[model samples]
Target: MRFGSIRVRLTAWYLMMLALGLGVFGVGSWFAMRASVFHAIEEELADRIRDVKTFLQDQTPFRSKIDIRDELSEHSVLGLGGDLFQICDEQGGWLYRSSALESGLVPIRLPSQVGDQPVYENLTVRGAPVRFATARVVIEGHPYTIQVAEPLEEFYEALERFGLMLWISVPLLLIGAGLGGYLISRRALKPVDLITTAAESISINNLADRLEVPKTSDELQRLSETLNRMLSRLDISVQKMSQLTADASHELRAPVSLIRTTAELAVHEARTNTEYHGDMMQILAEAERTSRLIDSLLLLARADAGEGGLQHELTDVSTSIREAMEQGWSLAAGKRIELTANLNSNPIVVRGDGEALRRLSFILIENAIKYTPEGGRVHVRLEGSHAVVTIEVTDSGIGIVESDQPHIFDRFWRADKVRSRSIGGAGLGLSIARWIVDQHHGSIEVQSQPGQGSTFTVKIPLAEIPAPLGQP
Candidate 1:
C-alpha cells in the first residue's frame, strides 16, 4: 500500500498482471463449458425427434383412427425419464401427449413452416428449463409435427456448481498470489537496504570502509564497485591535502621567523650603520624569498583550479631552448660549472603557449644548474622531426635516488630537503613545468642514478604542415 517504496510498487504490478491473466482464463473456461453442455443437449433432442418420426412411419395402414390413436397413447406412455413427445397435425390439433407435460393443452411456440429438417431451441415448460427439437414428417402422405423435449435441470445444476467454485477459488488464488509477489519483491530489494545502511554508516573519518559486494555479477555489483573506487580516490586526495598543509606551514615559518628575528635585533640595540644595513638586507632577502614562494604557490593553486589553459600557437621551441641555455650560462659561470647547448638547424614548430614553453624550458635548465656541483657539466639539446619535438637536459650532478624519482614533480617534494633549502628553492618549479608541458599535450620524463648524473627529457607534438599557396 506504500506507493513510494519500490517493493510495494513491484508487488502491485505483479498482482495486476496475475489478475488480468486469471480473468481471461476464467471467462474462456466459462464460455467453453457452456458451449459443451448445450451441444450435448441439442444432440440428445435431435436423436429423440428422429426416433419418434421413424415410429410413426412404421404404423399399419389398415388400422382405424381410434386404433392409431391407441397406438399413439401407448407410444407416449413408453417414453419417460426426462423425455417428452408430442404429435400433432399441421393445423395444431394435438393427437398425443407424453406424461412429462403437466397439462394436455399446453401451447408451445413452433416454426410457421416446419420441414423434415429438425430445429432445436431452449424453452421453459411449466417454469422448468427444457431443450426441445421439432420436425415435420409425412405418414401415408399426411403431414404431422413432432416435438421431443428433455428437462435441463441436471445440466443447470452442474453449471451452478462450477460457477460457485470459480467465485470461491479466484479470490483465494489472488490473495495467495499477492502474498507471494510481496515476498519475492522484498527478497529482491534486500541489497538496496544493505547499500543504504552502509552509506549511512560512512563518514569522512571512515571513508575507507566500503560496501560489501554481492556475489552476483549484476548492476548492483557494479554500483558497489564504482562507489568503492570513488571512496578510494577521496581518501588519497584528503591525504595529499593534509601533507600540503603541513609542508606549506613549515616552509612559511622559516622565512617569517628569520625576518622577525633580524628586525627585532636591529630595534633592540643601537648598532652601527653597517650592522643595521646588514640586518635590513637580510630582512629584504627573506621577504623576497617568501614572496616568491607565495607567488609560486598561488600559481599552482590557480592551475589546479583550471584557471588558465594553454594558448596554442605555432611556436619554434628551439628559440626558447637557446634563450634558457643563455640564462643558465650566467648562473653556471657563477658556480664554476660548464654550460652547453646543442640546438638543431631546423625550427621545431609546436602548438603551445610561447610564454609557458619558455618557462618550461628555463625551469629544466635552472633545475640542472642548481643541483650540479662546481666543475660539473650541464647539457641542453633540442632535436625534432616532422611528428614530434624533443628537449633533453642532462647534468653531471648529485642525482636523485630511485625511490624519490616518482615523487619529484609533486608540490613541495624534495629528495634532499636540507640541500634544496640551502640552494634556495621551494620545490615548485618542476611541478609547474610538468603542468605546463601537460597542458601542451606533452610528456616530461626523468632518468637518474644516485651520485652519477640525471637526464630530463620532454616530448611535444609537432604542428600540422601548411598547404601550398593557391592550392585551395
Candidate 2:
C-alpha cells in the first residue's frame, strides 16, 4: 500500500482510533474485574468472621478454651478449601488456630489493634497470595479477636487468563478491522480514480471532452462539474483564438502583398521619375495600413492579457467627443457628409483614461463615417445624468441586418466585407471600442435597421466627485 495515498491514510487513522478505543476498554475491564473479585473475597472473609463470633456467643456458659477450640474446629471444616481462621483472647493468648494455619503453609497475622470494624490485608504466604480480615468481638463480657484468610491463587489465575485473552484478541480484531477499513476507503474513492483517468486522457485537441460526472451528490460530483465547466471555457477561448489568428492572417496578407508587389515592380523595371514616385507612394500607403493593423492586433493582445494599463483619472467625456468629431470633420467633409455634435454646456466627467476615452470616441465616429454614404449625415451627442454619461453616435448610413448585429463587434468581423476592405477598415475598431468601454465599467450597444440608419450608444458611470478646476 502506498502510504501517501488517501486510502491508506484513511485506513491508518481508522485503525489508530479503533486501537485506542479498544485499549481503553481493555484497561477499564481489567480494573473493573479486579475490583469485583477483591470485593467478593473481602465479603467472604467478613462472613467467616461473623460466623466465628456467632459460634462463640451461642456457647454461652462454658467459655473454656477447650470448648471454643472444639467448636471452631468443627465450624472451620464447613469453609471452602484453603480457608483459615485463628482466634485470640484480649490478653494475647491463642484460643484456636485452624490446621491450615498450624501447618505453617499460611502465616496469618493478628492485627495489633482490633476495633469494632474489620481490618482487611493482603499477604503472601508460602509463595501464594492470600487475603486476611481481622475483627474484634465481645463474648460473655470478654474481648476476643478473630482473623480469617482466603487463598487468592484462583482469583489471580482468572485475571491472568482474562488479560491473556485480551492481548490475543485485540490484535486479531484490529487486523480484521484495518482490512475492512482499507477496503471501504478504496471503494469510496473509486470515483476520484475514474476522474483522474478521464482527465489524463484529455488533451488540447480534445478540450471539448468532459469528465464523467457521477450522480453521487457529493464532492466528487461537484469536482467533476467544476472541471467540466473549466474545460468548456478553455474550448471556447481556444476556438476564438484560432478564429482570430486566421482572420488576422487574411487581413494582413493584402497590405503586405501589395507592398511587396509594388516594391518588386519598382526594382525590376526602369521607370520615369513620376512612375517611381507613384510606386513609392503606393508602397508607403500599404506599409501604413499594415502598421495600423499590427498596432490594433497588439492592442487587443494586451487587452486579452489584462495588461492594457488604462488610467483611472477624471476625464471630460464631452471634450473627448468634441475632439473625435473634430478629427473626423475633414473626412466627413471630403465625402460631402454633414458631421455634427450636440454636447451639453457642462463637462460630463468620468473616471477613466483620457487618452483611451478619446480613442474610443474616435473609433466609433470614424467607423460611422467610413460606412455612411457620401452626402449622409453623422451626428455625435454627449449627455450626462446623475449617475451615468451617455454618448450616442447616429449615422445615416447603410444599416446592419438584425442577424448580423450580434457579431458586428467581433474581432475582424465586417457586415460589408468588400466595403470594409475598400475603406481600409480591418474590422478591429469596434472590438477595441468595446474593450475600452469595458475597462471603464460601462456598456455599449448599437441599434440599427437595414436601409435605415445606426445609433451607437455608450453609457459610463459618472465620477463620484466633480473634477477639480483646470483638471480636464
Candidate 3:
C-alpha cells in the first residue's frame, strides 16, 4: 500500500483520468439539459400565443370589448387558461385582460417594436420566475399584441434533482473504479513478486539452482529465462575456479615439500663442499620448477581475465621454428635423438606476437623431445598455404592414448604422470602454448597414437603483404 509502489501509482493515475473525464461529461450533460429545458419552455409559450391568435381570428368583428372578454372566458373554459394571458390593440387599449393581469399579480407590457416574430423574455411575477412571449398579429385590418407566460418552478425542480443525482453518483463511481484499478494492477504484477522471491532464495551455495521459466511468453518469462542463463554461467565459473584451486594446491605442494626436505637434510647433517654443492643444486632445481609453475598459473589467469598482452606484428614462422629447434637440440642430443627441420625455401610470414610464437614453437619441440626415446627422430616443418602458415612438430616417441589427447592442453594434466614428473614436466607447457595460439587467432591440434608418435600442428593466419608505396 506504499504510495510509491507501481500498483498504487497506476491506480492513482487511473482515478485521476477517470475523474477528469467524468467531470467534463457531467458538466457538458448538465449544460445540455438546462438548454433543452429552456428551449421547451420557450416553445410552449410560443404555441400558447399562436393559439390565442387563432382564437381571436375566428371570433372576428367584435362589436365591443365585453364580447372579446366573453369569447376569451369561453376559451378559458375550453382549457386555455387566461390567468396569465393578455391582449392589447394598436392604440394601447386593453382588449382582453385575464383576472391574474387585472389583479396586478402579473403586469401587462406591450413590446416596443411589435413585429411578426415573437419576442420572448423572462419576468418575475408575484415573486416567482416566469417566461413570457409577445407577438403582434394583424387580423381583418386590425393589429393585436398577444402575450403568454409560464412559471419555471417545476422545470427548476427537475434540474435540481438531476444535478443532485450527478453530484452524488460521480464520487461513488470513481471509488468503485479506483478499487478495480488497484486490484487489476496487483494481479498483473504478481508474477514479478514471485520472481523476486525466487531470486532471493538463490545464493552462492545454490548456484546450480535455476528459476522456473513461466510459459506466459511475456517480459516476466524473458526475465526468468535470462536470470536462469546467468545462473548457469555462474555455476560453471565457480566449478572451474574450485577445480583450479585444488589442482594448484596439489601441484605446488610437491616441489615446496621437496625443497623444504632437502634444506632440512642439509642443515641436520655435516657435509663436504661437494655434497653441499649438490644439495644446493637440487634445491635450486626444485625452486626453479616451482617458479615455472607459478608463472604458468599467472599467465593462464591473465589469459582467462582477457589480458593476453600480445604485441602483434608480422613474424617469420620458419625463423621461429628454427630457433625453437636450436633450443631443443641440446636435449635431443643428450637423449641421442636426431633433431631436424623442413623449412620452406622462402620464409612463411604470419601475424602474431614474435616472442609468444617462439615460445609456442619451443613448447611443442621440447614436449616432443621429452616424450621421445633415445635414437628417436624429432622433426619440425614450416609450411605456408594460401591464407595461413602451419607449424608441425612430429616425434617418434611414447605416444598418447586416444582418451588422454583431449585433455592434454588442460592445466596440470599429464597423460603419463610418472613419466611427466620424472622429466620435470608440470604439464602447463601445452596449456600455455594453446593460450598463445588463441591470442594470435590461430588453432592448434594434435594427432597421436600409442607406441607410434605424436604430431602437434599449429596454424596461424598469414599477414597481408603491403604493396609498394604507390600501389592501390
Candidate 4:
C-alpha cells in the first residue's frame, strides 16, 4: 500500500521494463557498429597491401628510378587514405619513399626470412596511428624490402565520433522510453482506475449504485460484476436485519405492555379472596404465554447462531417417520386427527443426525395435527430415489395462504396469527425444522392451499453402501 497510487506503480514498472530492453538493444548496436568500422579499416589495409604487391611485380622486370617514383606519387592519394611506401636494398637501406612524406625514407626492421613474407605492425607514424605492411622480395635476383603503411587517424576520429554520439543519444532514448511507457500504462489501467473511482462513490445511502461499464467484455467487466454480486448479498443481509429488529420490537413491546397493565389491574382488585384468586389465574396464564413466546424466540435465536450441532449418522427415514408419529400421537389424538404413515419399511437410508431429523419430522407432523380440523387426516411417508431418501408429510388442514407461504420458515411467522400461538407454538417450528435440514445438506419444500391441505417434503442424500448380497 505504501508503493503509491496504481498509476504511479504501473508507470514505474512499465518504465523499468522498457529501459531494460532498450539498454540491451543499445549495447548490441554499439558493439556491432564498432565492429563494422573496424571491418572497413581492415578492408582498406588489404587493398593497400595488394596495390603495393602489384607495383613491385611490375617494376621487377626493368627497374625505373624516376618512373617508379612518379607512379608511386600518382597513386599515393588512392592508397589507404594517403598510405606511405618505401623500397629498400638487400642491405636494409631506403631507396624511395612516398612523395606525401616530408622527410626521406626511414630505417625500418625487416624480418629475416628467405621467401616473400609479409610483416604487419602498428606504430605512430608522422604523429598519427598507422598500420604498416612490409614484404622482402628479389627483383632481377637483387633483394629488396617493400614497405606500405596507411594513416589510422580518420578511423580513430570516426570511432570517437560514434562514442560521443552514443553518449548524447542514450539520455534522449531513455527519456523517450519513459514517456512512451507512461502513456501505455495509463491507457492499459484506465478501466481499473474508473472502477476504483466508481466504487469510492458508492455508499450505504445508495446500495443500488452499480458500475457503469462499457460494452467491452473484459476482465474489468468481470471484476465489476463480482463486486456487484457481493454488494447485493450485503444489501439483502441489511434488509433482513432491519426487518428482524422492527418485528422483534413490535412483538416484545405488546406482551410486556399487557403484563404491566394486567398487574396494575390486579393490584386494584385484591379486596376479597375470590376476586384475588380470579385475578391471579388470569395473570399466571398471560405470564405463561409470555414466557413461552420468549422461550420460542430464544430457541430460534440459538438455531440462527448455528448452535444446534447435529449428532449425525446413518438413520432410516421409515423408522424416523414412525418415531415422529409416536412422539406426536397424543397431540393428534386430542384433536381427533388420525395420524397415519404410508411407509416403505425398506431401509430408507440417510446420513445425518438421527435425533435432529427425528425432531424435525415431529415438528412438521405436529404442525399438521394442530392445524387440521377434527377427524382430518395427517399422513407421513418414506419415499426413495436412486441415491436419496425423502420424508414427506401431508395433511388436511387450514393451510397457509399463498402470500404467506414464502416466509413460513422465518422465525415467529404465523399464517393464522390469532390461532397458532394458542396451539402451544410461538411459530418457530418451521424455522428450526428448515435449519436442521440445511445442516444435513438436505432441502425442504412446502406446498399448500387455503382450504385444502399442506405437504412438506424433506430430501436427504443417500450414504454410500458397502458391497451387497443378491437379495438381502
Give model 3 RMSD, 1 decimal: 4.6
Q: Say which candidate scores most in TM-score.
A: 2
Clashing residue pairs in candidate 3 are none
Arranged by lDDT, best first:
2, 3, 1, 4
Candidate 1 worst ten-residue window by lDDT: 104-113
Error of 3 at 85 (Å): 5.7
Rank the models by TM-score, top first.
Answer: 2, 1, 4, 3
Better of 3 and 4 by TM-score: 4
Candidate 4, superposed: residue stretches over 4 Å from native: 1-3, 64-70, 77-81, 86-96, 99-122, 132-147, 183-205, 211-217, 271-323, 342-349, 400-407, 410-413, 421-427, 465-472
Q: Give the per-residue lDDT digits (tens) of candidate 2, residues 154-238.
A: 9999999999999999999999999999999999899999999999999999999999999999999999999999999999988
The candidate scoring highest on lDDT is 2
Candidate 1, residues 5-121, lDDT tens digits: the string is 998988888889988888888888988998998888778777777776676667646776667667767766675212477777757777666756638634543334686887777
lDDT of each: 0.83, 0.88, 0.86, 0.75
**TM-score-better candidate, 1 vs 2:** 2
Write one digit per residue (lDDT tens) for candidate 3, span 1-472: 9998889999999999999999999999999999998899888778888888887777776546688778887786575644588888877778877766686565555544587777888888777878888888887788888887888878888888999999999999999999999999899888888888999999999998888787889998999999999999989988877888889889899999999999998999999999999999999999999998898888888887789788878888778777787899899999999999988989788887887888899999999999998999999988899788889999998999999999999888998788788789988899899999888888999999888999999988899989889889
Clashing residue pair totals per candidate (backbone < 3 A): 0, 0, 0, 1
Q: Model 2: which residue pairs collide?
A: none
Residue-level lDDT tens digits of model 4 in 114-143: 236566667776678876767766656677
